[model samples]
Target chain A: MRLIGKEEIENIAIGAALLGTGGGGDPYIGKLMAIQAVEENGPIRLLSLDEVPDDALIVPSAMMGAPTVMVEKIPSGHEALAAFKSLKDFLGQEIYATMPIEAGGVNSLLPLALAAQIGLPVIDADGMGRAFPELQMVTFYLEGASATPMVLSDEKGNSLLLNTIDSVWAERIARSVTVEMGGSVMNAIYPMEGHFVKKASIKNILTLEEEIGRTVREAMKQNINPIEDVLELVGGTALFEGKVTDINRRTEGGFAKGTATIDGLNKNKGSDCRLHFQNEHLLCEVDGKVRCVTPDLIAVVDSETGMPITTEGLRYGARCTVIGIPCDEKWRTEKGIATAGPRYFGYDTDFTPIEQLNAKAGITK
Target chain B: MRLIGKEEIENIAIGAALLGTGGGGDPYIGKLMAIQAVEENGPIRLLSLDEVPDDALIVPSAMMGAPTVMVEKIPSGHEALAAFKSLKDFLGQEIYATMPIEAGGVNSLLPLALAAQIGLPVIDADGMGRAFPELQMVTFYLEGASATPMVLSDEKGNSLLLNTIDSVWAERIARSVTVEMGGSVMNAIYPMEGHFVKKASIKNILTLEEEIGRTVREAMKQNINPIEDVLELVGGTALFEGKVTDINRRTEGGFAKGTATIDGLNKNKGSDCRLHFQNEHLLCEVDGKVRCVTPDLIAVVDSETGMPITTEGLRYGARCTVIGIPCDEKWRTEKGIATAGPRYFGYDTDFTPIEQLNAKAGITK
Candidate 1:
């Protein structure tokens, strides 16, 4: 186990937001909460998935609802711990550690914050290597893990324990409750034994976040191209360097869905790129040719600062660098493609590896 | 304790529908479920509140959501029991009996159905003497009862247990969940001791329902005026006898709200009455004069059959009789009026007793 202090939280938040791929919710508030928790309860221990005992009980946590709402109605900071305790009590067993449901945005910090507050260790792995909109989109779910016996808590000391037959139903029910609990809530779900956790989780995501975050920060400090550093660290390729020209967004069935157009700049000056998103950036097209789709990371970052821009924060006129990175090998499996591929988002295309797409376009470094 | 059999469910359903005042949802499905449960598990016992032991644990049950949705998605007949078992496990205490959260429509029969299925007795009382749209509008809430530690369950074996600061928050949170859970679910709430149950509940509402239902059914069979029999049985007065000339309705924020205009006929010809409602009928104005408002009962029944007409079922050109009955004395208390009076429903007027309004209008019989 490695000790995680306040400084590391900033790095993780930055890196997680990058992996968030324009969804996951903003990380500033969650970062502050984690900082406070660590200050009060001392540093948290970060444990590798392999280090956990085979019988150790693991609980993954996240914040569920509209990201826009979270920005306005700040959490009470106690909801996560409340949900954790409620679930622990329900199980009548001691939880060995806490883990992130997804390695993206604010949720990446929630489990860390909860672990610090409760004096527990956070697992180094996560359910999703990158963010997906729904609860059932996690690798744990695809690997046959159930999200039942979930606990949901709100700011006003209100908590609900949910049990569903499947993870999809868990998402559907918890989502409804989240909307009712004033549009946002903290949830503890996917309780599992260490054996299952080791098999289902995306290993070493915490380390990857730290590496990505540190690389970007150092590049920014040195006045180097932060985008180039991020691309090198994540083995990504710059898909488009442009200024956002237009954005059209609407919330349907509790999801923010939209399309954004970006006018290419500098070397690729006359071309245009478009992004289609449902919560997370799902598809990226350059001059009407699809370059990347879901299950492959499509990140839009600030041109200068290299900070990830959430879908809710996307605005016209912002200069951005869009990058495409290959997802973990686990997500390339047939089951994984079927779970979160282009077709799942209602597009008529199959999963195409980002590397192949980038090489075919002959725009390599 | 008194035994309740399948035969009595019809009478209670009829009377409870009248009490629903246009909302609480249709009672036909709930009544059928109750009949099936009784046939399968034998007759259920109905206990007087006074007879309950001081420490007896009583849990009230009800169905919450849009009445329109309930019609399309029939229940799986196991949600209420699922919620009950979940809550029971959480409380870690033996539940003594079941009771209705309200004496309106389907909710009135839920406790009976639950009791029959579980072979437990049902209390002969309810939280609301007549239906009100919100969970916090119950007499129990006005009497200082908390709706926390509540359990909500859907037909898919999904359950949620909520703990909130007060009943209002519980309602707000539960209503949101209801919408998410396909617009309706069963809830078991306000688990109180026997002593509190007796003080908070509208006593003997089950008996009242049976009496009102039997009176109406018998009058129809005997070729007597069913409307007159209903008014006499409930000590109500004829507010208006008319043909439904116009009906306008809309659902807002999950509640069915609307207005109906009736043209007076026969002895009451040459005048019109208008009823404004939110879930339950909240106000009635006859000949441009306010005659009855919330904290009183406003019921619309078929002119010929004396069958209660729900707000969702109100159609233009239907011949109807409108009646206003005095609410239970408990509802006239300052706290009760403040909880569900005219002003509570956004009306500008203070609550005026139905009897006084009838007297002023010179329509006493």
Candidate 2:
């Protein structure tokens, strides 16, 4: 285990925003929340997955609802504690650590903030190496992990403990309840024993996020573009270089769903790219041809700073570089693909590797 | 204490339907569920509020959703047991008895069925002496009794335990969850100590329901119209006698909300009556002038047999008599009226007691 102070939180937030693709939540807000928490309560302890004993209990914490609403209805710090306390009481077992369900945007750093305040270690593994919108879109779910007994606690002191037959049901019921609880609520979900978590989780996600964040920060200091380093680190492909032209977004069914258009720039001139998202980037198309789809990471970064931009922060006329990182090996499996593939998001396409799509376009760097 | 067998269920169903005031749930379905439970587990014990020890725990069981949905999606009986067990476990104490949140339609009989199956006593008291759509529209709520720690269980082995800041929040959140859980779910709610039950609940509500049922059944047996006898028993007035002409109904936001129009007959042939409801009848008018409005009770019964008709049972051509009963004294106070008054249900009038409305209409009988 090692300590994670404000610096670590800042670096993690940048990487989280990139992995978050176009959704999850705003990394800046996540950074502020984590920094304040660390400042108030001291550095947090982050344990590697291997360090957790088999008998230890780990409950991942998250915020569930539309990312749009999350910005305005900031969690009151106490909501996470309330959720953890209620879940721990319900399980009648002491929780050994907390972690993020996804290593993306705001969710990746939320557990760190919570750990600092609650004085618990945050496990370094996450269910999703990046992020997906729904609760069931996780490697743990693909491995047959149940998303409940789960607890959702709002800032209003209202909480609900849900026990569902399957993870999908957990998603449906919890989504509606989250909407009712005013768009966003904190969750203590997917309580698992360390043995099962070690088997099911994508390991070293936080460490990778920190590396990516540090790479971007150092590159910016040296007046260099960090996209090349980021691509090499994550085995990612630069899909498009573009200037944002238009965005159409609406908050619907507890999700911020929309399509964003980016006009091509630099080497990708004369081509236009369309990115579709529901909380996270789900599908990306360049010149009307699919380049990357869900279960694959699609991130947009500032062309100059290489700083990741959240979908909430994506405005028109921004010069950016869009990249596609290959997802974890676990997500390439049939079950994983079926759970969060392009088809699952209502796109009429089968799962295809981002590298394969990149090669077909014949512009590999 | 006494035993409640099939006969008692039959009588209570009738009276429960009457008090249900055109909402609650279908009486026939409630009777069948209770009868089956009694046949399998013998008679259920009936305990008056006075019989419960001061510190004994009481949990009321009911079904929440649009009445229209409850008809098609019959519960599998296990839902209530699951709800009760969950709530009992959460409280970590043996529940002394189960009661009804409302003494109306299916809600009134659901507790009896659950009592038989769980072998717990059924308290002869209820939060609402009659039915109202929302959870907080009860005497218990007026007395500041919380509607949670509550458990909502569905037939699909899903359950949610809720703890809200207030009863209104409970109603808002639970109602949305009910809609998501296939539009209906069983609930164990408003847990109270015996002393609090005695203070907050409407006493002898089940007994009153039974007496009204007996009156209607005996009147049918004697081949006489039971409306007068029923009126006398509940201190109600015959509001209008008519044949159903027009009914507009829609299930929205987990409630069966609509209006029904009746063409006058006999002494009231020249006039028309209108009834408005959101789960229960909340407003009644004759030719545009307001008559009986909630928290007063308005029920429709078959003119010939004097058998109560649920909102679900209201047919386009059914000959029916509309009756208005004075609500329990608890519902007449400022808090009570504010909780379920005419304006609360979107009617544009102040609450006028049924007696005053009836006297103004020259229907002293």
Candidate 3:
């Protein structure tokens, strides 16, 4: 087991944003809230999946709604804890610990804050090693765990407990409630036994985030190429190094969807890449050919600061480097591909693993 | 206590539609469902408010969303029961009776069917004596009863339990979920003790509906003027007798809003009346003078048959007779006026009781 303090929250925010692949909402407020929670309640204990008892009851949680709205609305800082308490009351069972629904952006830190406030430990693993747009896109859902008996709470002290037939329906109903609760809400879902959490979760995602975050921070401190260090540490390949030339964005069906064009520079001058995103970066195509797609991480980081740039923050003239990392092996299964592959995103091509795509393009790992 | 047989459903439907004031959806399917439930589970018992035990648990329920969508997507006939069951499980108490959230159109019969299926008696009182667009418009809400600990259920077996700060928030949040759950859902709300139900509810609204329906049907059989009989029975006044010359309608924010222009006929020829509505008729003007406003009933019925014409059924060229009836005494109070009067519906004029309006227009009741 490990303990998460003020310093650890900063690293987790940076790492989570990178893994968010441009979605997962802004991590700044989440980081601040988490830091405050830790400061007020001392350090939060983080338990490894293996350390959890078989009978332990764990519930994963996060914020649901438009990230843009979240920045302005700002949570009451008690919505997450309220959702946890309501769920605990409904379940009539002693909740052993809290877990992150996804290891991306703001959601990565929500559970830590909730744990600190409620005097509970947070499990180190997560439902998604990286962020995906919908609630049902988590690995737990892919492995047949239901997201029902879920609790959604808002800043106004309003809460709802949902019992849905399946994970997809859970997403549909909860989303409607989220929109109604002023366009955002905190949710505690996927209540399960420790055995199920161990089997269905993407293991050690918090540790992965810390490592990725530390690698970039150290590289920047030493005045080395932070992008290259990030790529090497994650076994990812550099897709592009360029200045953003154009960006087009709009909200459609409750999601931020847009495209960004980057003109390559330095060693790869004259070439350009296009990134298409819906909440998260879904695909990357260089020149004309598709280089990477969803289920693989497509992270955009500042060339100088090494800070991850979310889709909501994309703007013209930002010099950045894009990297493609392979997803967890569990997401490469047939079910995973069916759940979040290129076709699921309305793309015509089949999902080609990020590493395979890089190797085919003659980019050495 | 009284027992309602299958034969009584038709009268109830007719009366409920009249009280709907051109909203509350169609009562045909609801009538059929109620009759079927009665046949399947024996006659449903109807308990008067005074007969209810003080400690008995009472739950009021109804269908919410676009009435237009309900015609296309017929329920699986189990959604209401599902909502009741879920609420029952959550409360973990012995529910003694069911009640209608409103005595208008489809909702009037929902509680009867639920009572028959669950072997519980249905109270003759309802939250609303007449239908209004929002859930919080009910008399229970105006009287300070909370609509929380409510359950919303869809035909697909998805259920949500809401615990909100107040009745208005419950409506706001539940309406969003209803829209998301394919534009309609069944909800069981306002779980209260029998004593509270007696104090907060619009008493004997169901019996009033039955009386009005029977009077109209008997007048039609006897070849008497049914509209005049309806006016006399409800102590209402004949506001206008005309043919619909123009009708404009659209759905906004989940409620059907529209206006109808009527050209006066017979002795009233050479004049015109305009009826404005949002779900239910909220205002009426004759020769550009305000004749009636919400909190008072504005019902339009087929001229020859005395059958209420719902907002959904209003079309150009339909010959109709409009009537204005006084609202329940409770609705004329300060708090009641604030809840569902002209101002609440965004009308510029203050609420004028139907009797005063009729007297000023020289229309004797």
Candidate 4:
């Protein structure tokens, strides 16, 4: 695990902030909490999933419910630990490690805090590689992991443990609890052996987030395009340099789902591209052929500054560039597409590599 | 396994249809398809979970996607079988049994059809024991079951196998498939052994559905109160009969969520009750106490004919009666309340058993 000091929290938060694109909620809270956790318990140990023992207990921790409600209903903070502890008590075992559920936004920084404070090393990998609504939306769920025997805690310190028959019911019940708890709370779930984590997670995402954060900031200081820096770090590349022209949004299906329209700027003009999002950019199509889709990273950023724009933050008239970065080799597989591709996001297109999409468009590498 | 024939399907559909309470979508298509499947194969065998061996393969058959979409893009009637076949081929094993994911509307009957045609027995239980849209909302999801390795078949003859890392990802990918397939498709998921089915499922739901269906139908013909008959089926009672005075609806989070204002009838006249829905009747707050919630079946039916008024169908000035039935006892546990109680649904009230709630109101069974 790479060692990071006190200042890294702010740096990572800023990097996460940039990648957040506009939503992902204020990274400040996660930053503060993480920093505190780190300060209290020393630096978080960030290990690649590959470093994890196959039989080690690994749990993903995060906040579930309306993010809008999260600000108002301050979490018990202990909810994650409480839930984690309860599960441990139930299983009569101790947790060996922790991991983030999503690698972007508040979630990205949260586990750093959890790991530092709880004295458990956090895996650098994540489930979706991005934020998504619903507790069961993790990659682990698709692989048959349980979100049940989960612990839910409110700000007032009320805690409940559930052992449901399925993840969806966990979501439904948890959603109801979130609403009742005033819309946001803390949760720890998807407890499984480290082997599952290694198999499912995009390994070393925490370090990647830190590097992504550090790279963007360092590049900014050196006047390098942070987008390119991010692309390079994550094996990604720029898809298009453009100005955000229009944004349409509605909170639907438990997510802020919307479309961001971008007008080509550098070489092309009057041509438009559409980016569809559901808490995460699922599909990005330019002039109607799929340009990029998951399990590749499609990040919209500032065309001028190379700052990231989150799924919920796409706005009309914001100058931006869309970048396509490759996910791990696994996401490009048939299993990957079946789980996180364009078709998975409702696009009629087949899964195409971002590089291929760029090549098809005659864009120079 | 108990044998249910053609007449039983007709009878059960009518009863389950009534119990569906509008949000379950119409049972007409499900009944027709199920009847055809049963006719083509044979009467479906109904079995208790205990009737099967521990190793007996039990998979749940369901319709995935929006109810509105289901009506338009009717299954090619091949999707379920195709999905089942995919799983069977993937595992190189034959399935021994089948079950429904829920016991409401089309869900209750569709599995019977699948089971009959596939020459498998239908377990008289389901994960949810009620209709909910998303795949992860099932109790089985909580039981550490994965929806992936599950099969999804579209009308276009595309049978996709998803072996995701988690259940939530299953929904995301499946949802995208549904949208790409033009929304609505059949799926077979939550593959498990019979032992898990017995432990998790609400036992005898098929017979219960049949009885619930029959009780309401016979009540209508016998000139008895259909609402009363429904209440009797689950040891429930009438909360209040009323006229809907107002309805406010908007689709949020991919769900039809809204509120209905009912003018209390008879003894409670001049007072009003508010019913909230998100795909289904989630709660009923009369004169401001959170009266009923999810897990407890709250159905708003026509006063005279006893037809359920669904969330999407609630209209101003509609005459109706609101009935509250205790959900499957599984829902009453702490895990259940945490998963589906009023508090879970965003209400501040503590859970009160329906009978107790009735008794408090001075209403007798």
Best by lDDT: 2
Better of 1 and 3 by TM-score: 3
Error (Å) of candidate 3 at residue A274 is 1.6
What are the per-residue Cα lDDT tens digits for candidate 4 across A240-326? 677777888888766787888888886552267888887777788877778787667677777756666766556777888887766
Which wins on lDDT, candidate 3 or candidate 4?
A: 3
Assess candidate 1 and give its TM-score to the true structure: 0.93
Candidate 4, residue A167: Cα displacement in angstroms equals 30
Q: What TM-score does candidate 4 reach?
A: 0.53
Model 3, span B23-83: residue lDDT tens: 8878897787789889999999988999998988899878888877877776655787788
A13-86, model 2: which lDDT tens digit per residue? Answer: 88888888877788877888889999999999999999999999999999988766888988877788889999
* Predicted complex 3: DockQ: 0.87
For candidate 4, what is the lDDT?
A: 0.72
lDDT (tens digit, per residue) of candidate 2 on B1-365: 99999988999999999999987888888899899999999999999888999999999899998666777877878898899889989999999999998977789988888888888999998988888888999888898889999999999999999999999999999998998999889999999998989999899989999999998888888899888888888988787899999999997755678999999996662379998988788888987878899998999899999999888788899999988888998999999999999888777899999888777877675
**TM-score of each prediction:** 0.93, 0.96, 0.97, 0.53
Candidate 3 local accuracy as lDDT? 0.86
User: How far is A292's C-alpha from truth in model 4 (Å)?
Assistant: 22
DockQ for all candidate structures vs. native: 0.68, 0.90, 0.87, 0.03
lDDT of 3 at A73: 79
